[model samples]
Target chain A: MPVIEVRDLVRKFGDRTVLNGVTFSVEKGETMIIMGGSGCGKSTLLRHIIGSMKPTSGSIKLFGEEITTMPAPQLEQLRLRFGMNFQFGALLQSLTVGENVALPLVENSRVDPAIIDLIVKMKLELVGLTGFENLKPAEISGGMRKRVGLARAVALDPELLFSDEPTSGLDPIMTAVIDRLTHDLTRKLDMTAVVVTHDMVSAFRIGSKMIVLGAGKRAGTIIAQGSPDEIRNHPDPEVRQFINGEPDGPVPLKLSPEDYIDRLLGHPRQKGVAY
Target chain B: MTLRAELRTFFFLNREILRWIFLGPFQGRPVRTAAVFRQMVRIGVQAFPMTALTSLSIGLTLAMQGAQELSRMGASAYVPNLVAVTILRELGPLLVGVVVIGRSGSAVTAELGTMKVGEEIEALEVMAINPVRFLVVPRFLAMLVMLPVLTVFGDYIGLAGGWTICHFAMDMGTATYIQRLMEAGHPLDLYSGMVKSFVFAWLIILISCQSGLGVSGGAEGVGQATTSSVVTSILAMLVANAVLTAVFFVF
Candidate 1:
């Protein structure tokens, strides 16, 4: 059985539906990537999977237990089995990187201080952040912060981990660095990971299975779900265009009537072409 | 959830408050001393000057009013005693409460609200640190500890201002005014003021910390929480003062 199972999940913000009847599951050790545009509900779906937000309908099962219907105390207890890396790194700004990394050990477990220190150092070193544990989040570069977040998420050796926009503000090289660290951690630790990202390159690097979310009425419906190469070569024109970064495609930019007319006049269309 | 769950949450929140206070002694773990101290200084120390100035000015005004009223009855000598009792018992405690609500109360709310928005609180929870115990308790302890000290300072400055105004401006004998103030004000009266100060401090911290933890939405949510903290603290302080006054006077 999958470690995490989300079935027909739905969420709406007032009149607008952000996630519309989405269903997916992450197996025990699979690195699944949820990919989409800015408002495509990838983060929303991730939130539900992590039990941060309640679904409008359907159910979420974590480790074969129905989480949505569990008591608050039980749910809190169940939360320890999972870890999440926020989009902005979300490391406690007031704490040193070491403190941030050791927080889970300090709070959740009664491990020895010596052991915690060793584990914290090891986790930071794994992310290539050795000896920089004394530095605050502000002192580190954005990519380093993301790495620290990854270290913290894996601090307790959780079976399932979720990362939201892990490469949001990093340079391309740094993005790859974070992506590789994530890929290496999952592979080496034999852990399950669900990553949400818009960076196609970073997504392709670590995503064993990728799910794409589209817009509007089908906001969170999986437009495509397969291996990276399979998604890149999808038969769906919308998926193909998005993958290739094409300007003129099935996903047309909505323009005002005056601007639409201007575009038509500025670049004279073929005689038989429709506006 | 049932009523039992609500009750459990209440007790849990209270226990969390005490946990943070006790945890302060064990500095081996990550201690947010600098942050707490900075917040206390910003909320308590920086607010001192304004509280003093307001207290002195208001004390002077109260003395002036007392002089005018008592003079009509040929009891102008009573003005010093009236102002002394008023400053130590009512004005000092109440004014400090209001100042803290504006200064520290709103600050606690905004800080916690931003932490909520940034998911720092949730991160703490996932790390198995109870956010209420980790964050709210320290703030609550700081405010509770500082307000009484600040109130005493405010009372001293206020009485001195009243003495100065009565001695010089109101044309009363300095020695006589001091005699009346010392004779009329009891140690019990001072005790009442101190007690009220502690209660007000608790109210300010409780309202601010609770409102902050209650924050939802985004940045706008934080702003709303800050406003709510101030308003609620002020209201709670006022009600607590009234209750304390009734107990002190009636009983």
Candidate 2:
């Protein structure tokens, strides 16, 4: 059975619809990447799957159970099975990196502190955050913060993981490093991973399956969904244009004049080059 | 539609609120001194000048008004009694409470609101920690303990300011002002002021933290929560003070 199933998910803010009739599924042990432009509802969709936001109308099943409508306690119980690496890392500023990584084990599990310490160190080592556990989030570099967040996300050995823009604000080299780490963790643990990212490179590097959001706005629909090769060769003009970084495409319709001109004049746009 | 369902929902929310109160502030078992010290600096020390200044001005203004009115009635000697009673019983605690509601209250809301918007709160949830129990409780405890202490300080400064004005500015004898102050009212009036300070403390922390954690948007959301926190806490304090006054005096 699919590990996650989303159907007819519709979300709106005031009169502006963000997601409309979006649907997809991810199998166990697979990495599914949701790709879109800014405001295309990729993050919104991820929030929906995580039960952080209520869909206007839709259904979401995690492990064949309808988790969308689950109560807080039940949803919390369900959350234990999965972990999330936030875009900004979101490690508690007050805690040391070691404490931040050990948070999951400390709060949710009965594991001994010694074991948790060992595991936290091991996870940090895996993400190249070794020996820096004593530092707080503010004391670390941005790239290191993301790694610590990743370590914390996998702290409980979660069977599933969700990362929102994991490579955001990092150098390309760091982005590649994070991408490799994510791929290695998923393969080694055999865990299903869902990543919402706009970075085409990172997405292609890690995504086994991909969902492309936004065609003409007005509640972005899934314009395309398939494997990396299939997505690169997607028949939809919107998908192709988005991947190729074209100037005149489905995206320019919503762009500000400055953004349009910046792109047209080849003034480096801060392309959503993030995980 | 069922009573059972409604009750169940109510209890769940109530538990969440309680958990936030008890567990939120100490999440990660934050070192008490560090957190309390931060709050003390923020809520207690930083608030002192404003509290002192506002209370002093209020004292001076009250004495001036009291002297003017009592002088008209040829009872100018009652100025000290009036100032002592009003300052000790009401304005001292109440003015400090309002100032805190603006200062510490808005700050708590903005800080927590930013954390909520940034997903720091959710990250805590995923770690199996209750954000409320760990983060909110300590702050609640700190505010509850500190407000009364600050109120007492404000009351003393207010009385001193009032005394200085009456003795030097109003051409009143120090002995007369001192005597009137001593015979003004019962000790219970001052005790009630301290008690009200505690309630006002809870009101500040509760409203600010709740509004902060309730934030949904990004930075803009934190701003909105801060504004709402000051407005709500001040209003709540006013209503609470009136009720407390009535209960203390009428009953």
Candidate 3:
């Protein structure tokens, strides 16, 4: 059975429709990467999957149990089976890295204090945050902070993992390091992972199966979904433009000289934002 | 935000906090004792000095002012009665409420707002922990317990200040001052102030925490929420005190 399945998910923020009829599924041990430009609802979709958000319409099933309708306590139980790493490393500022990583084990289970300490130490070492455990999150660099967040997320040895924009602001080397860490953790644990990102390198390197959210008229809908090589050599110009980060293509750029002049002259939106 | 929106959010948050407080014990050995104890120290014990200083100074001012007016009318002996009644019924609790709102209320709001913006609140949620149960309940209980204790301490210090002025500045005998003070105010007056302190503490706590939990954007949002929490809490406490006074005394 699929570990995560979202069907016909539609979310509207008042007048704006953010995710329109989105559908996807993740099998056990599969790393599915959801990638798109900004505002394509990649993060929004990930939040819905994690039960942090409720879709305006549709059903989400985790482990074949419907999450969209589960009560709070029950949903919390379901969340325990999964671990999530957020963008910008959402570590508690007041806690030491060891405390932050140990939070899950401490709060959820009745394990011995010694066992909890051992688990925390082991998780931190996995993320290369060994002796740095005593330091607070503010004392750490951005990359180390993200790694600590990863350690905390995986502290419980969860079977399913979700990461939102894991390597967003890091330099190329740090990005590669994070990507490798993610890949190693997935392979080592046989965990199912869903990652949302705009970083093509990180996405392509880590994704076993991939989906690209289309721009313009096809916004919030999948334009392509396949293996990494299939996505790397896809035919769609919009998909190609996004994957290659090209300035000019099916994906729209800023206004042209004539359009800029026209907009300055008070004529608004002469063309759609994306073609 | 509109006043109506703010009011709605405040009511909802307070209801949720109260729900967790009353309904939480059945959830199997709920253990937040350490958290509540820490909050009690932060909210009540550490506030003693400021509460004492404010109450004492206000008592002195009231004495000097009342003696100045009553001496002209040859009713200077009534000064103790005036000081006792006023401090017990109004200034002690009100001053303590204002001090706590400024000091601990703003701090709580800022701390929680930063937590919310930094995604610590969301992190708690993702960890299968109820943020309200973990964060709000301990502070709520602490405020309810501590405010009255602080008010009682402040009331005594205020009475002491009044006695100091009466004995040294106004040349009144200590025995006469104590007798008049005892005779002037009923125990109900002190009890009424305790009730007022209780209400004010909850208002400050609920407003500040609601502000913190609602914070968005970034550090700028935290600043805005903290400012709003303090301003709104002080105003609400004053309005509430007037109502409670009318209910307890005037009616």
lDDT by residue (B37-153, candidate 2, tens digit) is: 677778888899999999888878888888888889999888888888898889988999988888888888888887887689987876556676567766777788778988989
For model 2, the superposed segments whose C-alpha errors exceed 4 Å read A93-99, A110-121, A130-144, A217-219, A248-275, B1-15, B19-41, B56-80, B126-128, B163-182, B216-221
Per-residue lDDT value at B143 in model 2 = 84
Which candidate, 1 or 3, has the higher DockQ?
3
| Best prediction by DockQ | 3
What candidate 2 keeps of the native contacts, as a fraction, is: 0.58
Q: For residues B1-251, could you state the per-residue lDDT of candidate 1 as single tens digits?
A: 35577446546676767655676357343445665676678778888988888888878888889888999999988988998899988998998788878977898889888888888987776665668767876676678778998999999888888888788887878788888989989988889999999988877887777778778999999998898778878887889999999999985
Taking all chains together, the TM-score of candidate 3 against the true structure is 0.93
| Residue B213 miss distance in model 2 (angstroms) | 3.3
- What lDDT score goes with residue B96 in model 1? 78
What TM-scores do the predictions have? 0.83, 0.80, 0.93
Tens digits of lDDT, candidate 3, A149-228: 88888889899988988887777877887788789868877999999888887888899999888778888788898899
Candidate 3 error regions (>4 Å): A171-174, A268-275, B1-11, B29-31
Instruction: Report clash pairs, candidate 3.
Output: none
Provide chain B TM-scores across all predictions: 0.88, 0.86, 0.96
